[model samples]
Target: MSSRKFSIVSGFFLQDDQVHATPATIGALPPRFGLVDDSPECWSKFKSRIAELNDNASSGTTYKVFFLGRHGQGWHNVAEAKYGTRAWDDYYSKLYGDSEMTWGPDPLLTALGVQQAETARTAWLKEIPNGMPTPQRCFASPLHRALSTWQITFASDESFPQVMRKVMILENLREEHGVHTCDMRDSRSLIERNFPPPTYGFELGFTEEDAVWQADVRETKDHIKGRAQSVLDRIFDDTEETYISITAHGGIINGILAAVGRPSYSLPTGGVLPLVIRGDDV
Candidate 1:
């Protein structure tokens, strides 16, 4: 890998868990505040990706709308900005000494990051005032920056129908981990305390401690590919939610897009892009 690539591979936070669950195999999608149980028609609509059963069908009716978002800028982004890619690859450890102790763990969003989140909300208000693209089910990276972005994006929005408000924290959605100290998330207890119910809540059956995180390993992009495919597979298979949002990192967002055969998207901080997933995509 080039030095720049090395910087990303070694310094960027990534979550590399290989989720085996697919939509077909995942037993059930956890309940979301806004999702309805799947119907046979919904499955039928899901299977026919190339042909729209109804040409004029709204996004909420036929397409599995995904609003994939990147979290706002964090302190880590600032750190990366301080050095050239080559410098970072060579001197990241020596200059910083230790990642966690030197820079700290799970850095929160910077002021600009907060602004980015606000911008997303404002744009949504202007464009989709009725919450047409608002997510019924939301998933976010477990890291602090991502969680903070998820909070800020919806901070003032009363537009989300009651069901779209709940947020699920997914370890799989985390950025590449073990490479960056800023990627380290707080313990499950801290998450439950910080992002509580009403605004953000955990999936009922998901665990607080994750074995995948405990593994303490960094994953290659190819591995991320598998992870992305699994995430997409499970999301489409498990839920009947018409609209969904994922608050994640840039790399992971690319993974998701790549998994589904879409061109990679460049999402800015707090950026939200809607993607329609069909059953056949998996």
Candidate 2:
């Protein structure tokens, strides 16, 4: 086999476990990251061909993504009520009653919520073709609810290797013109003030509210979107065929999808959304 002996600009020598290169080496190296001189036909031709392959793959390759999930049920759901106006709190108290409004640090899934997660898992498993590349990466929000969902879905499956990453909280997923928070149990006026005109639900509405909860309650949509996008960018940058699985809050998923120009899709407690990121996008 014929081999070219051109120097790399900067690269890891796995045998030595160290990085190497100088300005001189960089100047003589192939243009772009992770390139090596294994072929000598015009570099431009190789690059162009690779670009074409990437576009074709992105458009045609069906990426398999499994969304492990966490229900939004948490203690904060009730604590936020106390901060609302007395009238609002009274209305909420009547609605939910004293059924232990908030969950503890590691809350158990509600009956209906558990069903949601299981349904999501079953649906994803059915969609993925057998013997496809196992999930290349798995990420989850730091919250227990989300973590638990991930554990339940992939903990026993050897196919998916899992890792946890901090992501923007859910409250930041709203449209710029929408409200930030609302008393899910009460206060029609507060709901109107905090949420968008087309509400999601009436029984436990205010899934999109941002009242006077806390200064830190609000995360800039732009910032959160950037962080989520960065996660995707890094994954795509690293490999030509990386399949990423992110187990995160609904909002974080929505933010990342939005950044990629997809319509906002809600991630149920254990829903999965598979995305194929083309190498060219990196």
Candidate 3:
């Protein structure tokens, strides 16, 4: 495996066992901050702390803040919930869908999913003015649910910060490849038609057809982590954005957390995780 370029800087946030609780949210962070001594728990202070980390970073080292959001509930989630994980994984996940709903080749958000995205929108709208460092860059997985969540959570409302409205679609940001039909993305042409450019751009050299997925294969956890590492390498190498937002799947998010040396916390649908990461030369 290629050398890692980033590691999580803990103690600044409540990212330990506290985040592992059911229905946990980013707001669960402690009010008294350590990033800046005696600083109050507010967005402005958080932004200032990030700036300080960057300004003081040593040569060949850089610090960035990433807001990783998991896409809201999809039909696949519903199916899994209905069937239970073992059955879904062993039998149902490979199929196009159940009799009631379609989840194959990319499933869109369910009603609950849309509402979950709206909740995220409300949270961002409420926080941005409170000194939330607006994400300098935004990215999303190409799957329909993630794309839709990105749109609804950032661009649907005109009142949101303009910077949050646009996002680049990264294939590497997608869920673990193959086996499960829900993890299989649709054609690039269809994705473009649904999420057009200016608002949604593709990574350079992105193929028109789904390339990584295989109907008979399921990517192992280690492979997913490697893919996540490659995507992070791309981002850190190609851009200097200090604050970034990525909308993706639970598996992808897990891989990202792992790549950055964070604990294996299960982010719920529409859940957001913020990481203060320090990147350095290997």
Candidate 4:
């Protein structure tokens, strides 16, 4: 892979204290979707600004906008909530789930999760008319929850056709891998059965079964950040899409944000964060 680094570009988004202080929840588009200045055509202006940045960028450098979306409430989320973070991390996460639910080896979304995804879909529908650029490309974690979230949010509607909204599943985008059954993804064949190709595509070298996940070894945050950087570098090197979307887990998205030097902010289930970043070959 090419040696590349990324940095957050402020001034375009309302990532200022005021907006970041607010709770980022499902369907809660940051005040005017975090536009630095409010206007009827704010999104259009923002799009133009991105184009200008790329057009003026020196060779080996490019600017792109990323929409980082967290998957809706999975059974694991509910399990963690019920069990509390400490207990869940120590005990519950290792097992499949409690008696009431099963969240392991890629659990499906809970009902609330589905509702949250629908809310995300509605949010996108409301913004498109406001000049929000439909994502030129969409990427998702191999995990089922993230895949389902992407399907509901971007691919469910006829307004966004499949040709325009192709989703690529990336293994590196999966949540901090290992130990937690919730982090373990299902077999690729199973995933393909549900989210079949023509619309859903897997990254090159994707394996048939879970390859990186190991039940005994949990990945460190530093390792997750490194993985995030690797995937970002791959995307920057291979794709020309200016507007991109990634549906992934909280830890994975957090690593992505941190890798780009953005402030840390927790996204509620189904929540989305928009960031503008510049990548330079080192």
Per-model TM-score versus the true fold? 0.70, 0.47, 0.91, 0.94
| Tens-digit lDDT string for candidate 4 (1-282) | 786889888777655342444544323466555666678888888888888999999999999888888899999999999999999999999999778999997989999999988988888888788888888889999999999999988888989755546799999999998999999888989999999997899988899999888989999988988999998998898888888899998899889877887656777888887878789999
lDDT per residue as tens, model 2, 1-282: 111111111221111112342323432111321134334443354335434644565432322222324344344334444546465434442333336554333234455555555565554454333322344455544334554455555553443433222122232222221122222222335433433233111223334333423322345567657665565554444434434555556566666655655455543344444443332221
Candidate 4: pairs in clash? none
The runs of at least 3 residues in candidate 1 whose Cα sits more than 4 Å from the true structure, single-residue gaps closed, are 1-62, 89-103, 204-210, 213-217
lDDT ranking from best to worst? 4, 3, 1, 2
Error of 3 at 216 (Å): 1.3
Candidate 2 least-lDDT 10 residues = 8-17
**Pairs clashing within candidate 2:** 67-272, 179-194, 180-209, 180-210, 181-209, 181-210
Any runs in candidate 4 off by more than 4 Å, and if so which?
Answer: 16-28
Off by over 4 Å in 3: 1-3, 16-41
RMSD of 3: 3.1
How displaced is residue 149 in candidate 4, in Å?
0.5
**Judged by TM-score relative to the true structure, which candidate is superior, 1 or 2?**
1
Instruction: Please say which candidate is ahead in lDDT: 1 or 2.
Output: 1
TM-score of 1: 0.70
Positional deviation of 15 in candidate 1, in angstroms? 25
